[model samples]
Structure formats: structure tokens, C-alpha cells
Target: MPSTPAIVVTDLVVDRGKKPVLRSVSTEISAGTVTGLLGPSGSGKTTFIRSIVGTQKVKSGTVQVLGHPAGTKPLRRRVAYVTQDASIYRDLSVKANVAYFAALYGRSRHEAMQAIEGVGMGDHADKLAGNLSGGQKTRTSLACALVIEPEVLVLDEPTVGLDPVIREELWDRFRALAAGGATLLVSSHVMDEADRCDRLLLLRDGVFIADDTPADLRAATGTANLEAAFLHLIRALEGVN
Candidate 1:
């Protein structure tokens, strides 16, 4: 039998001020796989992530995580979400912030320390989060999420302000997490980053225009890269009869 999906959304819809931000969006994210959500600005990528995180209410349809309905606090506990804003305590030291988050997730100090070290932030543990550079802050946020050891990891524009080197490093860590059996749902405007995912879910005007592996998407669109394929798919969808 095929493995059960870690996440399932059936005919999901979300509206924002009379405008439908998501229209009947449906997709499944499998265990131990990295699924990238790709779209342009205003395409509702963040909104979609918010819906999955249960921070945004939908108008219709169903969402399930680990077979439990969305918005269940217990179910959410097993899913970690890292927003693009890096919502860490700016005044707190890196270690303290991570420890606090871990505690919220029921982790002890020792476990939090291990998680921080795992993200290569051990040396800067004492530095204030606000004093760190953009990349360091992003890494710290990711460390906090990892401290929970969640079964599902969701990230929105995870490497937004990071330099190329740090972005590559973060991608390596993400791949490692997936390899270790964690399910990942990542949203990115960067086509290069999206290409690294096990599968891609392309959004256009709040709808899923294409869902396929990078290789398959490229093949289907006869394009050389994800960006080109994305454009092609959007054009095709727009021209649908």
C-alpha cells in the first residue's frame, strides 16, 4: 500500500474581504518529502501557509494533518511553522529564545541546546537575537522550530534575506530533515530554491496551476528551469477553454 500522506487538503477555500484568496485548492503532502509552494507576490502563498497552520480560517473544505482535522491544538503541536518574519524575541539571547520555544513544545534545556548546536548556532548562543545578522536570525528561528522535533515542518520564505552561501546551507539542512523522515512544506518565490524540493505546487491567482516534481514539471512544460515552467503553466491555465 502507498504511504499515508502527512497533509491533505480537499477543496479548500479561503476568502479575504470578499475576494477569494484560495479557491478550491487541494493537494497532499507525503511523509518524508519536501514540498515547495511556488508563486509570485500576492498569489496567496503566505495565506495558504497560514491556513495550514490554523492561524487563518477557511470558508469551506477540509484540511487534515497527520489524519487529524486542521485547527486541533494537539495536531498543531506536532507541526512547526517558521514564518518569513522570523518571529523570535529580538531582545532575548539566541539560546534563551530557542530554549523558551522548546519549552513551549515540551522540550528541556538539554534538548534545546542540542537542537541549537545541530543548527550550527552554538557559538553565537549568547548573542542577542536582535544583534544578529539577517541570516543568523533566520537560522535561529529554524533552530527553534527544530527544537520541537516536529513531525511536520513548514517554512515560508525561509532564506529570504540570507546570502547565497547561507541559503545553500539552509537548503542542505532542510534536505537532511526530510531525509530523516520529517515532512516539509516550504513556500518560496525563488525558483532555484523551489527546484530543490521533492515536489512543487505552483500557485497562480490563489489556485494550484501545477503540482509535480521539478523534473516532471520541466518535462511537461518543455522548459529548462522551474521559473520557465511556472510561467508556461500559468499561461496554459489562463488559456484553458
Candidate 2:
């Protein structure tokens, strides 16, 4: 028998006020691999992640984390979410911010320092979070999330506003995390980052139109790159009218 997925959804549907944001959507993410949620802006990537993280309640269907129903406090404690906006305390120093998050997760200051060093932010530990550049802030947020040693990590537009070098470094860390047996679900508009994932879920108009590896997607659409493949997929989906 096949193993249960680390993350699963069954006919999940979410409505925001008058309009529906997700329509009977279902997908699964397994452990030890990275799943990229690829979509254009306003395509419900954030909303979908939010739903799984318990920040948004669905109107219908069910979501399960590690085989349990969503929103259970125990399940939530094992999941970490990093939003597009920096969720750190801007007024605090990098070390202080990480220490505070660690405390929330029941870790000590020494454990927080270990996490900061592990993410390569030890040198800037004393710098104020708000004083750091965009990439630095991103790294700091990631460090805080890592301090909890979560089983599942959900990131939305993690590399936004980062330079190419820093983006590549971050991608390397993501690959390392997946290699070490963590389940990762990341949303990004950047094709380069999407290509690094083991699999991709293409989202358009608040629905998943394609779910496959980056190479498979490119081959299916006869496109040279992920961006072109996305364009082809969108055009084909629209042409179905």
C-alpha cells in the first residue's frame, strides 16, 4: 500500500465573501521533497497556503496534515508558515527576534543562537531587523521559522526583492532542507525558483490547472523555459472556451 501523504486535501473549497477562491481543489505533498506552488499574482497561491496553515477557513471540504484534520492545535504546532510580508519584530535586533520566536516555541536563547548561525545570520545578530536589507530580513524570518524544527514549512514568495546570488543561496538551503527530510510547500512567481522544486503545481484563476515536474511541464507545452510553459498552459486553458 502507498504511504499517506504528509499533506493532503479532499475536495477543498473556500469562499471569500461573495466569491469563491478555491473550487474543490485537492492535492498532496509528501515528505522529503519540495513542492512549488507556481502562479501569477492574485492567483490564490497565498490563499491556498493560508487555508492549509489555518489562517483561512474553508467553506467546504477538508484539509489534513499528517492524516489529521486541519486547524488542530497539535497539527498547527508542527507546521511553520512564512508569509510574503516579513513577520519579524522590526524593532528588535536579529538575535532578539530569533530568541523571542524560539521562546514562543519553547526553546532557549542558546537554541536560538544555534538556529541563527545555522542560517548564516550570526554575524548580523546584533543588527536591528528593520535596519537590514530586504534579503537580510528574509533570511532572518527563515531562521526564526527553522528554530522551531517544524515538520512542514510553507513559504509564500520567500525570495521576493532578493538579488540573484541571495536567491540562489536560499534555493540551495531549500534543497538541503528537503534532502534532510522536511516537507516544503513554497509559492513563487519566479520560474527559476519553481524549476528547483521536485514538483510544481500550476495555479491560475484560483485553481490548479497542472501538477507535474518542471521538465514534464516544459515538454508537455513545448516550451523552452518554465515562464514560457506557464504562458502556453494559460493560453491552452483559456482556449478551452
Tens-place lDDT per residue, model 2, 140-237, is 99999989988889999999999988888888888888887888999998887878998899988778988888889999989899998888888887
User: The CA-based lDDT of model 2 is what?
Assistant: 0.87
- Tell me how candidate 1 scores on lDDT: 0.89
Shift of residue 171 alpha carbon in model 1, Å = 0.7
lDDT of 1 at 60: 96
Q: RMSD (Cα, Å) of candidate 2?
A: 2.0
Pairs with steric clashes in candidate 2: none
* TM-score of each predicted structure versus truth: 0.95, 0.94
Query: Which stretch of 10 consecutive residues in model 2 shows the poorest summed lDDT?
Result: 1-10
Write model 1 residue lDDT over 1-241, tens digit each, in one string: 1266999999999999899999999999899999999899999999899888788989998889888887687775788999888889999999999999988878899998988888778999999999998889989999999998989999999988788988888889999999999999999998988778999999889999898999999999999998888888877777952
- Residue clash pairs of candidate 1: none
> Model 2 Cα displacement at 192 (Å)?
1.7
lDDT of 2 at 187: 93
Residue 6 lDDT, candidate 1, scale 0-100? 91
Q: Rate the local accuracy (lDDT) of all candidates.
A: 0.89, 0.87
lDDT at 112, model 2: 97
